[model samples]
Target: MFSPFDSILAFKTAIYFFLRSLLKGFLRRATGLCELQRLCYANNIGAKRTKGVEKSILLSRCPVLKRINTQLDALAEADELANNWSTVEEAVEATMVAKQINKSIHEAFIQPYRICLVQIYGYRQLIVRLDQIRGIAFDHNNEVHLVLLKNLWKLLCPDTELEGMISKQWTDIGFQGQDPSTDFRGMGLLSLENLVFFATVYTDHARNILSHSLHPIHGYPFAAVGINITHMALSLIKAGYLKTHLYNVESRIYTVEDFHKIYSYLFASFDKLWIRSKPNSVMEFSHIRDKFEAAVVKKLQFEDAVFRWDPYLETI
Candidate 1:
């Protein structure tokens, strides 16, 4: 049924298709192997060429490829056999140049890790400093600290001058005892600093809160409450909870100022909470303090939380 010429043409057509399919498959494998080698080099796996018969077949495609391979091989081994460390120091010069190139590669590799390390180191250093601050005793003889404290008291009570440590104004501000230093036992000088910062920076709001401490049935000890708020702030910092409010990924940590801000916010927030809660008596202080702390912790859990002046307090 078929002519001999037609049979010969069909055989040639089938051979053509077979060669084309083989070539397509070989090209795909070659492309994939090249990609794989590049990936290995990128990940520092080290690149090595195939040897023996495979090496000859691999580089047979283009003359440019063979030349590049020869140059690269020569450069890779140049440091091994060279000893130009005499008067000229040519080998030393070559080594330095290689190191310069290698340094850039090393920096590229370790940059992310270095950033992570700096962040972790900065955080740990902040915590250590916080701990150190909390452990410091309120020095009675430190004239500067004493002057700061006096200024704070004066700012709060411009009309009444607190002459001695055992003044009734001390009780008016809510110290637990005649000497305010006795109450600083738990929080050390840090609590005093918080009080001074709040009193000095936010004078009107501080005075308003001081006035609210005189509420007939629900009066709370203002200074004692401030110290407790400082404790809360420190606890949050130590537990890493304050990072949500105190830090951003790329921002520097302002540990002292941030803590002072928290203290001020606590005072303002507590005053508002106290007015709303309308507690029966001063005996309810612990219950109110706990409720206020819970509220603070809840707000700080939010991703974008920041302790700031209350809108109403700012107006005052």
Candidate 2:
């Protein structure tokens, strides 16, 4: 498995980074600015600046800089959401002090660097909140869960009345069985929340996508596929594959609402792709889903990728 060419390429890459680090250190000494300050002052605002700041923090050897992220993680684990900004401000001050940079002279670097820190750490906080929600299994007996489930049905099927809680009519909306509770095992309440958000916020688009799922020949399980899309979105976020897109799209702090928007986009895009593929049957879902996911991942690899829902595309 270890070819000579592969070994040589790896060695070259390592040396390149080592030399680059040395150059950066020399430049910092000459310019009297830390790597983060230099990046903030040099790069344009938005994704490019944010991404550079993230990489700088990840690669920094300074103990204070390194502990900044660790402290943020600890705060998130303790559910200290209110103190995230204060913590970030403290870290920025500590970083300035550690590098012995006078904030009075380089006031411009403060806001840009702070904004990037907010985006970076805010993303981590969002992941923690999402994980907490995803861990909650669907409970049929819970009043709030029952209300959400019923609300989903009413939003999708306004005229149809439920025969009972376990009626076969549940399949009309694409639940695999009369009782939809069993389907929420993997993603838990997150799946339901995504579906409700899509239906309630983007009612027309949601209905249109649902109609496509009812296609006689190419019909797929709407609810199940939506849950799968939720899982895909979460996986990408956790893997840092969504950083570029989120950094570009979300100027403010990231939230569950942003995650839901991503899910809606994926679900709509999947529907469009599925129709274009003209599959022989629903059995081909796995193949088509893999191809769609690969395409999405490729798109997200770029520094400026921002996914948006195209309502007009539904007609195409």
Candidate 3:
């Protein structure tokens, strides 16, 4: 016969996992899980809650919780009954834990730079730098203007023909080199995304390299939403730019996932920013395109005139 103490202990333990599972699952979804596997997605986010909340989570799992994670482990153990038994218990025990831990196994191995946390300084200076970059890069004439801005417009303002604004801007700016689109695209010299990207890089590098002497963009609510390096890199690729600068050699492991995040954020999330402007079918909205291009050019022109564009550097 089972002793009363042993039976009581098992009952309490079961009740504990049961309530813990329910609370974790419910709480995680409410916090923006997008989608969660209901059967076994108590994202291991470590939490400290009262036992009463814990017990309720456990009591509801009579037929469900204990067996939820067993089959996968059991199948892999095929015929090794001894191993399968141990695996099943381990799986069940793990389910009692949450997915989002205060500390994670990856903690020991990965050192992630939460991109959102970094500080950006000096907007006027950043604008000056962007302008310097622009004066050199875009000061050329070609159908290339039409192409580069068109692609960027498609991303920044889809469903519109930005060719006119591109033409007007190039002419007004007195473009002098090879049109950036035809000469430096695909091979990665001066794509539109390059502006936002290299600005971050050069500014940071300049600040680091030169210490406080270098000025950074200030007072612009510049921010990156998530630690999605993959998304950033793909943004580079999708915008027809190069993926050279997103990471060091150590980050090669998470590169694919990072790219996916970049693709999702650009094409899927802020992509709508591309088409968010009010449409003026009757009135040529090309001027709005001009304003946007000018904003970009303004950013470029506002910076130091020294950072001239040389399409050749893109290839090298």
RMSD of each: 21.0, 3.0, 21.9
Over 4 Å off, model 2: 1-20, 310-316
> What is the C-alpha lDDT profile of model 2 across 147-201, one tens digit per residue?
8899888899888887877778888888899898888899999999999999998
Best by lDDT: 2
| Candidate 2, residue 110: how far the Cα is off, in Å | 0.5
- Candidate 3 wrongly placed segments (more than 4 Å): 1-136, 166-191, 195-316
Per-residue lDDT for 1-316 in model 1, tens only?
Answer: 8999999999998897677557645854775323222222343211121111123223234353344334333432342111221312332223224323243443342333222222323444565666676788877788876776688679888998788855666877888877787788898888988899998888888898888888888778888888888888788777766665554323332356667777787778888889888988878878988898888788767656666565453631
* Candidate with maximal TM-score: 2
* TM-score-best of 2 and 3: 2
Name the runs in model 1 displaced over 4 angstroms: 1-120, 310-316
Task: List TM-scores for all candidates, in order.
Answer: 0.61, 0.91, 0.18
Clashing pairs in 2: none
CA lDDT, every prediction? 0.62, 0.86, 0.31
